[model samples]
Target: MEKVFKVLIFTDLDGSLLHRDTFKFDEIKDYLKLLISKGIFIIPCTSKTEREILEFNHELGLNLPFICENGAAISGLELLNIDLPKELILSREKDDLLNIFKNKVPINLQNKCKWVFEMDKKKQSLVFGLEDKKLKMALNRKYTIPFIFEGTKNDRNELSRIIKKDNLYLQEGGRVINLTDRVSKAKALRIFVRFFKKNNKNVKTIAVGDNYNDLDMLKTTDFPCLVFNDKFTLDEIPIDNLITTNKPSPEGWADVIKMALVKIDKN
Candidate 1:
């Protein structure tokens, strides 16, 4: 008899599973539930804060573990009674990262970027399209600082050099550019995949995303999917099992997942 394989899925929330502009997953909610019912684990690997991802999990009624703040930290595994290594947390402390940004980047160039936290409630809402409560949740980040760069190409290059000199990095997501220490979605995904494989040796990993930040994670999985995003194109990836969705957001998410489920059933 053929051995049955356990499937684990890692997904980027914004611009992949949820509508990029509205941030709603209603279109694929039922399908997501169906995947969960079939014992397929869906892990949200995103740049969202813990609070925001937790809220999303609560809304979806999924108790799965999640990677947050661009792989700065992983949480919710305690519910599964799984003990993860402390070193799995890859980013530096939030305050330290912010301080590095302030001290490294020149004040003149810094003036061109708007730090999300320093903005007032209304301005924050205007920039992020979130209301007061949601904006508050987004601000509760522990490891990464999101900002909008309002400078020219040369200014951005200068800022990048300044940040690199301080041992920090920048990740461009669908909405904002994040400043973080040495942490990435790929690093966190590897940790989780190893943990999962220890229990189920036949586990196959699937990863889906829509932006540059998702590149590493997508490349790390057995099955890689790139969801369509009108605002940005994916960087060149050299994976053979890669798939691209024709539509965007919840529609594209549902399509790819359904296809994966069918292929798994066949196997």
Candidate 2:
């Protein structure tokens, strides 16, 4: 008899599981809990900082294993197995990466990048669409720097080129771009899948996202799911059996997850 495949859902937070503007998920709260009760794993794999993800889990009342900072680190892995590491740090420190940026990148390109943390609280709230405690959690990052690029397309491209030369990346998001190390959601998911497969032998991954930065993580999964985003389009995505929904998240997240589960059962 063939062994049953353990399903693992690696999901993006903002614009996928949470509403883009409000950042709430009341619609799918019960649905997520139901899935969790069924022994399925819903891992939040996101560009969010560790504190932000922790705040998310706090609301859920579960200490779920998570990959944060666009896969710069994995936390709570030991919950799955005592032998597994409690926390895994996969990327360079945020300050170290910034130091490299300061030394290698040109002054003109650097000036074009507006660091969000340095901004006033009101401006930070405006840019992130988060306020007070949420805003503070979002800014508590260890491996990535969020910034607004106030430069032309050519300048943005030049900055990306220069960052790439130094083994760094400028990940594009909706309103803000992030400076990350070589680490990415895809790379992090790949590592977790490798570790998970050791015991399960047969496992299937479902990745959900709604932004350009999420494309790689989506591509790395057995089931690539896309949520509705007016700001994001799927014209360039070439994955087979890619599930999508017209309804925006958190409804869209439930829609795609249900679709992926059905597809899994049919296979």
Q: Please provide, for model 2 over 1-267, each residue's C-alpha lDDT reduced to its tens digit, 9 standing for 90 to 100.
A: 765778999999999999999989988989999998998999999989899998999888888899998899998877777778888899999999999999999998899999998899999999989888999998898899999999999999889998898899998876689999998999999998888877788898999999899999988899999999998787866878899999998999999999999999888
Give the range where candidate 1 is weakest over 10 consecutive residues by summed lDDT. 79-88
In model 1, state the lDDT of residue 16.
Answer: 92
- The all-Cα superposition gives candidate 2 an RMSD in Å to the true structure of 1.0
Relative to the true structure, candidate 1 reaches a TM of 0.92
The residue pairs found clashing in candidate 2 are none
In the order shown, the candidates' Cα RMSDs to the true structure are 2.1, 1.0
Candidate 1 residue-wise lDDT at 78: 54
**Top TM-score model:** 2
Regions more than 4 Å wrong, model 1: 80-88, 235-238, 264-267
The alpha-carbon lDDT assigned to residue 57 of candidate 2 equals 94
| Alpha carbon deviation, residue 259, candidate 1 (Å) | 2.2
User: Model 2, residue 151: displacement in angstroms?
Assistant: 1.0
